[model samples]
Target chain A: MEQGLSNALNVLIVGMATVFMILWLVVIIGNLIIRVTNKYWTDEDLKKSAPKSNHPSASKGAVAAIIAAVEIVTNGRGKVTKITKQ
Target chain B: MDIFSKLFEMTAFGIVTYKTVIMWAIAFLLLFLGIKKKYEPLLLVPIGFGVLLANFPGADMGIVAAENIELPDGHYKNLFEIAHDYGILNYLYYALIKTGFLPPIIFMGVGALTDFGPMLRNLKLAFFGAAAQIGIFSVLIVSMLLGFTINEAASLGIIGGADGPTAIYTTIILAPHLLGPIAIAAYSYMALVPVIIPLVANLLMTKKEFKINMKQMDKLYPPKHQIKNIKTVKIVFPIVLGTVVAIFVPSSVPLLGMLLFGNLVKEIGSSTSRLAEAANGPIMNTATIFLGLSVGATMTSEVFLSPKTLGIVVGGFIAFAISIAGGIVAVKVYNLFAKKKINPLVGATGLSAVPMASRVANEVALKHDSNNHILQYCMASNISGVIGSAVAAGVLISLIGG
Candidate 1:
């Protein structure tokens, strides 16, 4: 009985850990790639009218929600520092 | 031979001895619900077939009786023994079925089909979705009060999350013996979302209260970094949950783990597209078929004919309705606190109907005030519900199975 109980515990731990590890790698790498792409894609000055990169309501350096969420979680709450337009 | 004797023999052969026909009728009902009502046909099809197989006698009965196989050359060994000797998969069906692996893959398909875009626009919906899952606890408490074991209560309560995979995942870990009843009940309620949710939603809100106008949260397409954050969230979310679960219930880790892995595959950008395909295509599709049938295989008359199975069915409906009520109540609370007129109707979408529930909320909102576009808000809640229920399921399993 003790062995059975321990076996169940083992199954649970190993399974959940695998999921966690996989997610950590995927999310960390995926976010980095997205951040890099965003840096290149941003149009600092509305040089091309078509490049409506600057958010209509947000500040010049405002990130997307997905990015903002990641930054806030990883870099800490204060690190996010949303730069809303004055 | 007496004529009565012949009739009795036929009756024994067909009616009492072979209960497959009645079970098949139930399977047909599932088919009707899937095809006609369009209630989660992906799972219902497989689940219905499983019922047919499970009810049919002689499935595993012969094998159950035989401890070993005897060969003419004086060799006798168990199925597992032979499998070890021959390198074959022993009771592979049970491995996937009893362990609850396949259902979570079905969830991956569900996750892939989900679009969190609307959810991003109005993140407040997450709170509402989270609130709806409160039913898991309430039901858990009730089940425990009713003298069920801790694991049984937890497994029973997860049905309130309204996510079949989470319910199955939780059950497989906490109470493997109750898998048949719990799974059947959970899937049945999930498929009946259209009917069950409306019943609960109406009970909570009147026509006037249900159709409040909520402000449209501004659309901000996620920046690249934000997209990555979401992916990171997708990744960490599962792991954090798994870790927490491991420390607690531990039995449910496998179901949670596989589910998270599938989600991780989707978030990993390099393989995102392929991961998306696997979640939606062959792996998910095939698993649904096998999982449902294999689960059905467990529902033999001897086990299913009991009052406990009936309790699972009743408990499942109660759990689902309570969660729906929880969502409605949470929305009302949010409205009172935020003082921003938000539709209580949108909260029902937190039952994880994906776009369908959101669309239903949109339709309801349109009926009241055409200008109010609450469907998007509802969609955010819908996606959040997916995550909310999954985590809640894990927690419930830990508490109960521990």
Candidate 2:
């Protein structure tokens, strides 16, 4: 029983420490990977790879308001072209 | 009258004992839970049927140890002898489960299915997953005090990981005899995540804490680091993380390595999508069926009806409760120093039950304030819990499994 308890104690201390150490290493390395990759990797492929957005189009009221504001600011000189949601 | 007596001896009714009857009831209960309550029906149904098959009188369907097979030469049976004598269930149990093959394959499937986006977005929250593993070691000590051998206690303690594969894999290494009870405990508690998470959260957290809005905290203190190309990061993460973990705890490589490999294939897109699909679909499903049946076959009336099984049931529950509370407390401690307060529900989800734990935490958060959806944040810790528990299992196996 004494030997068993001692072994159990050893496992408790070492198991938790190792778990935390390895997982923390994962977190640190994971973050570093992100930073290094971002720094070196070009985003030229991003536009092509990016999925088409399925977001709903802006309402008529919102479009009218934007056009009205533009008309007011430019004193009827600005023309309304195509509008797309970012 | 003599012919009738001889015929009666050929039937199971002649040999059935109360133990067989009791095992039947237990099997029925598991089937009821799986079929009616829908508690992990995919696994429980097969396992329940396997249990019933093992307990059937005159069938000899239960898994038998090599040493247990009596021979005139007084030597253990080889695989051929066991296969020839004891049949298919025993053969599969020895070949698949005892060899420790299926759990990691299922983990590979789990990895292919996982999305590590939320965890990468909130890296600091991953620490809570490590903190939640306190339950495993703590239960190890307690089970020893309760008079279990160190190996048996380690197997029991792994049930706290709340991951069936991890528990079974560790048990196969540390104490194969305890595999049946440990697997059942792990899966049963996992199915009870909805009930268990709320129970632990309600006890440890305040209403104000429950209402802590994660989105509000994010708005107040915006994150600085952002992944410029998420696709590239996803593809690179499993490789880097797998290397680091394998270096530190080589024992974890078998399980974690396969997991990372599966994730890599999935992230690689069109080139490896077929591999990912095969892994997560057919390969994983096949492993699950064999794993479930073999594990259930180990639970014969003689193995499972022991007093030790009762201890496992009770100890498994305490381990689960402690793991949940450990996560919640870690979040509370983090809140004390940081400007951004996290809901304890996020911490409570630091178990390896996957989306279920995260969903439960999300519901608790929503109940307090309908707009407060912390599912993504909860997933940060939930996914980490999978890695954490697997690492913990590796540590235990390395330190004592020899």
Candidate 3:
């Protein structure tokens, strides 16, 4: 029972870690897209290209990096290379 | 003084402490191999150091007893007297390693972090995992016939699967005596996958088989809907499998249960993060430290320095050879009826070293044709190998450990 509960706890951490990462990514990429494309297009066009969840247009890299770090801890060097290549 | 001098002359090298000297030499060799040559240094280095501490004849409590301490690494209760309170096996292995809990936990983090879409897309790779079991049994039968007790044979047989935990788990059940060599052999061979698999792959496959063109797989990011579905399957698959295996063979409950539980935790996706953390975090770290050290402690002179150890070492090689051959040949046979033919090298991934074996298959496939990408297809074989080896270990434990 302890083992099961411990495992369940780990799953939560992994899920949150993954969400935090994805959220951060959406934010950063959103910002970059808005800033980069604002010069070429308009704010209305940007909204059409990007979906608006709670994640704003900032801190994408931070989340992306954290997710990558957690993955590296769990999976090791092998998958990191495999994912980057993909 | 004259009697002491006479005793010194009677030793192996006419030295009073020849045995201690010999142990120290062995220790130096392990350290050198681990540090200089980089052969399984991560494990061997620590193991080598432990060996040094173990064999140092005067590590005994002799100095404190003031009996005129003369040697090193030998059993002198005066210096290292505390060791007596904890026999090497009890303090190290039974207390830590033999609880049968750590390796499967690691597998959970593996499942969570792992992407199974590759195997899902190509279900045929399961055959390769099945193929690897052939090696396990072949080694088992041979080892038993060769005069090893059933447990030893089972432990030796696991080497073919090229999995460390399964081997360690099997040894703990079947032949705890041989755990030291068996675990070391399994992990050593795993770290040598890049070296060993290629040699075996080169020997087993014909130029034609090696050169075959594998299909291209799509590399689309998993869509949101599909990802959710996979999450459900992953969680359910474990509980169902664990119940079946646990019911059939309670002996395998610790290993099979832990593995599936890890997988389920991974599958649940949102229940709790501690499951993954255990597999990925403190549990793994603590187990690794204790496991490696205990394994090292078990390698005292009496057990490790025997001719039978040679057989255990040889058994590991045989297991690897049989497993790799089983995997490659199974792929070729499966292709005869199937609409699709995969690179035969992927069969080798059935040994279940996780992404490493599968990645090696990808490398071999790429060698034949740069454009070919068989990794996704091969991954099924790899994961199946994981399940296959675990079940195989369970079977051996039931048949033997029971």
TM-score of each: 0.69, 0.91, 0.70
Quote the positional error of residue B135 for candidate 1 in Å: 1.5
- Model 3 per-residue lDDT tens digits across residues A1-86: 34433433443343223322322332233334334434455444533543223445435464446445765566533222222211
TM-score ranking, high to low: 2, 3, 1
State which candidate has the highest lDDT: 2
In candidate 1, which residue ranges exceed 4 Å CA deviation?
Answer: A1-86, B1-21, B59-90, B216-271
The DockQ values of the predictions, listed in order, are 0.06, 0.29, 0.03
Clashes of 2: 0
- In DockQ terms, which candidate is top? 2
lDDT of 1 by residue, B246-278 (tens): 554354455545655665665554435567777
The DockQ for candidate 3, computed on C-alphas, is 0.03
lDDT of 2 by residue, A1-86 (tens): 88778878888888888878877887897798789877987465654543343345766567657765776567556756656666
lDDT of 3 by residue, B70-96 (tens): 246663333233335444533444445
Instruction: Superpose all Cα atoms of candidate 3 onto the true structure and report the RMSD in Å to 1 decimal.
Output: 13.3
Clashes of 3: 38
Error of 3 at B317 (Å): 0.1
Q: Residues B193-285, candidate 2: write the lDDT tens digits.
A: 999999999999999999999999999998878888777888999998998888889998878888889899988865677789899999999
lDDT of 3 at B92: 47
- Those runs of model 3 whose alpha carbons end farther than 4 Å from true positions after fitting are A1-86, B1-26, B29-42, B60-84, B87-89, B101-115, B217-228
